[model samples]
Target: MIFGKKKFLAAVGDFEKAAGARDGEAAERAFAQLYQAAEKAGDAEFREAGPRLAALLPSVPQGPRAAVAVVTGACVERGADPSACAPAIFAGARAGFEAAADFCARWAETGGGELPEPDDELTDEIIGRTGEEPAIGWFTLPQWEMACVAMLGHRSVRRESAGTAELLALAERVTEASGHEFKCLTYALRVLDDEPLVVLHRETGTGYVLRMTGIGDNFQLHTLLAGVLIGGQHVPGDAPSAQEVAVCRDAPGQVPTQGSFNLAGPDGAWIFNEGTPSDIPVVDGARLLVLDPPPYRRGWPAGRFFPGMPGDLVLDRVLDEAEAAEWFAKVQPAKG
Candidate 1:
C-alpha cells in the first residue's frame, strides 16, 4: 500500500469530527483527504475497513452516513468485495441514508458500474423496490386515488442522483390514490428564481404564460397535477415540450392585450399579462387555457418586479382533480 493504515485512520478521524460537527466545508475537505487515503491504501486495506465502516453507520447522523456511503461506492468501484459488510450497509440504507441505497441500486442494476456485483441479497433488495409498492416513502397520498392506474413514465435515470428516489416514491403514492386508469410523466427541470414554471402554452392563434409564485407549496401542487394526468395513477414526468411547462385550457376573451392584468389581487391572485402569440398549433377540443399568449420577457436585474414579467408571474387559478382530468383528456389527445 502507498499509504499506511495509520494515515488512513487519521483521515477517517478528521472526517468523522468534521461531519459530526456539521461543518460542511471542513467535512468536504476532510472527505477529500479520506478519499485519497482510501484510494492509495489499496484494495486489501479497503476491504478490511469495509465492515468497520458499516458498523459506524447506525451511530452517525445523515451527513456522516452519506460520506461513508461515498467511501463504500469508491470501494466497489475499485473491485473490493463488500460481502462482509453488505448486510449492515443495507440495513442502514433501508433505515434512511438514501445515498447509500442508491449507490447499491445503481451498482446492482448496472452490474457494479465498471466493476463487478458486490453481494446477492443487496442486489435483490435494491431491484425489489422498483417492482413492489409500500417501499420507503411510498404512502404520502391515500391508496384509493391510484387503484386503477396502469402505466408510469419518468426520466430513464438511476437512483444515484439526488431527489430521484424520493420523487419516484412520491409517484408511487400518488398513483395508488388515483383510482382510475392513469398514465403519469414526471421529470426534473431547471427551476427559475426558486420557482417552477407552471404554465406556458402557445398556439398559432392564442396562448398564455403563468408562473408559480413560490406561494403555498407549489411543488406539491406540481406533483398533484402529474398524478391527475393519466387518471391520477402514474409518475408525472417533466413538463412536456419545454422546461416543465404546464398546458392548461385557454380561457377565451379573458386574454388581456399587451399589458399586465392581475387576474387575482394580493392573496391567491393570478397576475396575468398578454404577449406575442406563439406559432404552435392549438389542440382541437381543448379548453382555451389562454387566448393570447404572452411574449418572452427576460426579467432580471430590475424588470422582474413589474407585472406580466416572468419574474412577477404568480398562480391565477388551480384546477381540482375533476377539472384537471377533463382538461388533460382533451389536450392529451391533441398536439399543441
Candidate 2:
C-alpha cells in the first residue's frame, strides 16, 4: 500500500522488539508486516533497504509453524513477486531451522556436477523466463535453500490432513497467491505427508493399493508426480510369494476380507483376480496383506518406481483391524 520510509522502519522495529522479547508469534506477525512493506517500497526504497531487511530475517523469532506460509502469504496479499524477496529470506533461514535440515538431506543434491554461480546473463535469463521464479529455485543455492526451508516450515506447522487432490489444490493456490509455482515443495507437503511419513486415510488406503501399478503411465508427469515428490523414490508392485500371501483368516465367514491380492510375477492371478466376471470366485473370510507405504508417501518422483531409495516405502501393511493396529505400533508417529 505504498509504504514509505517511516512505515517500513516502524514495522522493522516491531519485529525486532517482538523477537527480542522471545514472542515468536508476535515476531512473525511483525515480520509479515515488514515483508509487506518491503514489497510496497519503491524501486529506490527496496534497493536501499532490502539488503538490511534480508540480513535480519535469519534471527527473526520464527514461530512453531507456517513461517514460510506467512511470508509467502504476505507477498501474495501485496501482489508482490516472491522471487524479489526469496534470496534474503532463505539465506537467513536454511541453517536456523530443523525442518530445513531434514529437507536438505533428501533434496539438496549436488546434481549435474557443481552448479556455477548465476551470472548476470543467467539472472537476466531467469527474469525473462515465462514461469521460472527469478533468483529463487533452480537458480542460486540460497534461493533453493530458501524454498526448501519454507516448504518444510509449512509442513511442520501445517494443521491440515490432506489427500492427493487437496495437496494439488493448495499448490495451485500458492501459485495464484504468490506468483511462484513451487511445484516440488508444495507437492511434497501433500505427497510426503510428514517427512518420514507413516499414516493412512481409509479412502486412500484402499485406493493406494488398488492404484498401485508397476510404471509407464505414458511417461506423463501429472499422472504420478506426487509419487516422485516425496523423495527420489519408487514402489515395486511385485507381489510376495504364494506362501507369503497365504492368509490365515481369523473368522470362517466374514465378507471376504477386503484386500489387495499380490501375485508372484508380472502375469498371474492378481491381474486376473481384478478381471471381469469372477475367475477365482470370492466367497467369505479371505485375507489380504498389502505391504506398501502409507498413501501420502506413495508417489515416486520422476517416475522412479523401481531401483528405489532406502525407507521409500517398505512393509507398510494394509492388514485387517487387528494386524493393522499391531503394525502401527512399531513405527513411531513423526513428531513435528
Candidate 3:
C-alpha cells in the first residue's frame, strides 16, 4: 500500500470538519477513508500519524461514541502508544452520554483488545497529572482507587481532590473503604453561611489568606473523631467511642505549614495536630483534639496492613505559615 502524506492530511482535515459539524454519516465516511490511508501508510508514516490522530481525540463533537472507539482501536492496532491516547480517550468517553466503565467495555468490544491496566507507577503519572483540564468524570477504575488508597499522602492525589468535588468524594470513599486515614475529610467542611474564614499563620512573616466559601453545617465533634479513628473498619456491631480524645479548647489561631495535620497522639492513636499537645496551656475553647488509637483488632483484619501515609493518611498541601492558618480557618472554623 502506498502512503501519501498529502492525502492523509487531507483525510484528517475532512474528518475533523465532519466531526465538528456533527455529521455522523459524513464523519464516519471520512473516518473510514482516514483509517484506510493510515493502514496503508508505512511504519514511520504511521508513527507520525498516531499523535495527530490521538490529538483529535477527546473528540470535540459528541456525535458517535462508537466512532471514537473505532478510531482509538485503529490507532492501537496500528502500533500507536496507548498511554499517549488513553487519557484523552477515557476522558472523551465519559464526557459523552455513557459512564466511563461502560465506555471501557465498549472499547473492548470495538477494538477486540483490552485497555492497558495502569499500575501504581503509571497511575501516579496519569491520575490528575497537571496541565490539562479536569476530565468530566469520577474515578471508576479500581486500580485508580487502590492507588489513591496506597498513595494518599501524595501531592498529586491531594491537589487533584482539594478543589474538585468528584475527586474529593472519591478520595473519601477510598479512604473509608480501605480503613485508611481520612486525609480529605476536612475539605468537606463547609462554612456556616457562605462566609470565608481568615486566620493568621504564626510561622511565617508573610501573610496570605485561604478562602473557603460554602453553606452547610459542620460535622459533630464525636462524628468527626470516629471517622478519623475507625474509618470504615470497626467491629460488626460495636460502636467506637470518641471520648478518649484530649480536647484543647483554646488554641492560638495558628496552623502548621502543611494544610492539615496527622500525628501520633499520646496514646498512640493518630490525632489532628492543632497545636503542641503536651505544652498547650488550658484555653477556654476546644480547638485541638488528641484522640486515643483504636483498640487492637477485635473483628478487623489481622494481617499486616501496608501503611501508606502516617496510619495511611493523605498528604496535605504545603503552605506558608500564614497560608496554612488561612486555609485551616476557612475549612475548619467549625472546630471553634
Candidate 4:
C-alpha cells in the first residue's frame, strides 16, 4: 500500500474540516492523493485502508458530490472499487445533504465515467439514486385529478432517464388508482433544479413535461404540470399545471367500512394500505380494522388501522372509542 492509514485519515480530516467550499476543490485535493496512493500501494495495509477512507464521505456535513468525485474519479484514474463509497454518500443524501443530491444528479448527468457496469449492491445503490438508474427516490401517487387523465392517452416516451422513470412509475400508480388500465411511454427524465421531471410524447402532437414533487410523510409524491406540446410545438408553461393529485385520507369511498377485523396483535396491530381507487379497494372495503401500510408494499397498504375498533360511528374514534375506554371521558362532543 502506498498511502498509510494515518495519511488516509488525515485526508479525511481535511475534507471534514473544510465542508461546503465555494467549490469542491479542497475536498477533492485531499481525497485525490489518498485514493491514488491506495490503488498503487504495495503493502496490504494500504489497500485495506482504502475502503475505510472512503467511508468518511457520509459523515461530512455537505459536498456529497465532492466526495463522489474523490471516489469515482479515483476509479477513472486507475480502476478502484468505488462501491463502498456509495452508501456513505447515500446516507448523506438521505439526511438531506444538499451536495449529496447534487453529486447524484451530476453523476447521472455524466455517466459513472466508464467504470464498467455495477459490480455489486453498493454500486447499484449509487446508480439507482442518481436518477440515471430506476427508482432512485421513486414514489407512486395514488390519486390524480380526472381532468389531466386525457393527455396520457397520446403520451409516448423516448427514454427513461433520471427523474423520468420515477415520474412514469408515479403516473402508472396514479393511473392504476384511477382504475384506468394504461401504460407509460417515457421520453426522458431530467433533473432540473433538483426536481425530477419527465417529458412524454403524444400521438397527435409532440408531448408534455411533468414533474414530481414530494410532499408528505410516508412515500408519497404529487405530479406537477411543467410543459406541453401541441402539433410538434413546444409550449413551456410559465405557470404550474392546474391539475392536482392527492392521497384519499378519508376512511374509504364506501365511507366507514363496518365490522370487527380482530387484529391478532395489540401493540403492533394496524391494518391499512395506500388507498388505490378500486371498486373493492382493500384498504376501504368493509373491514373492521386498519393498519399502517407495510413498508414498500403497495397493494392496499394501510395508512392507519383503527385498532380495537368497537365504535359504530366515524366520530367514534375521536368520541365513542375514547369515551368507552374513558380515555377522553371528560371531553364533550360538539353536538349532543
Residue 230 accuracy (lDDT) in model 4: 18
**Candidate 2 residue spans exceeding 4 A from truth:** 1-5, 35-39, 62-336
lDDT of 1 by residue, 1-336 (tens): 225555665666776677568777876777678777775676665655555555555655553454565465445434444444444444443343233234434444654433212212233454354322222212212121121010011111121224434434544334343321112212221112223232322122212223433111222222223223212222222222211222111111111111211121112223332211111123442213322222332211111111111212344445555554443444322212
The lDDT per prediction is 0.34, 0.34, 0.35, 0.29
Superposition TM-score, candidate 4 onto the true structure:
0.22
Worst 10 residues of 4 by lDDT: 307-316
Clash tally, candidates in order: 30, 6, 5, 26
Query: What TM-score does structure 2 among the candidates reach?
Result: 0.24
lDDT of 3 by residue, 1-336 (tens): 324565665677787788678787887888778766765565554445555655676554443433544554454445555445444543443343123333343434554253333222224333333111221122223323332232222223333333334444444443443333333232321112112222222223222222221211121222322333233332122333322111101111211111121233222234333311222121123122232222332222111112122111111223466544443343321121
* Per-residue lDDT over 160-243 for candidate 2, one digit per residue giving the tens place of the 0 to 100 score: 322324334544543443344544444333323212212222222321211222221111112222223222223333332222
Error of 1 at 44 (Å): 1.6
Stretches > 4 Å off in candidate 3: 1-6, 21-23, 60-63, 76-84, 95-336
Q: Where is the poorest 10-residue window by lDDT in model 2?
A: 247-256
Decreasing lDDT order of the candidates: 3, 1, 2, 4
The model with the greatest lDDT is: 3
TM-score, predicted candidate 3 vs. hidden true structure? 0.27
* TM agreement with the true structure for every prediction: 0.27, 0.24, 0.27, 0.22
In model 3, the Cα lDDT at residue 177 comes to 33
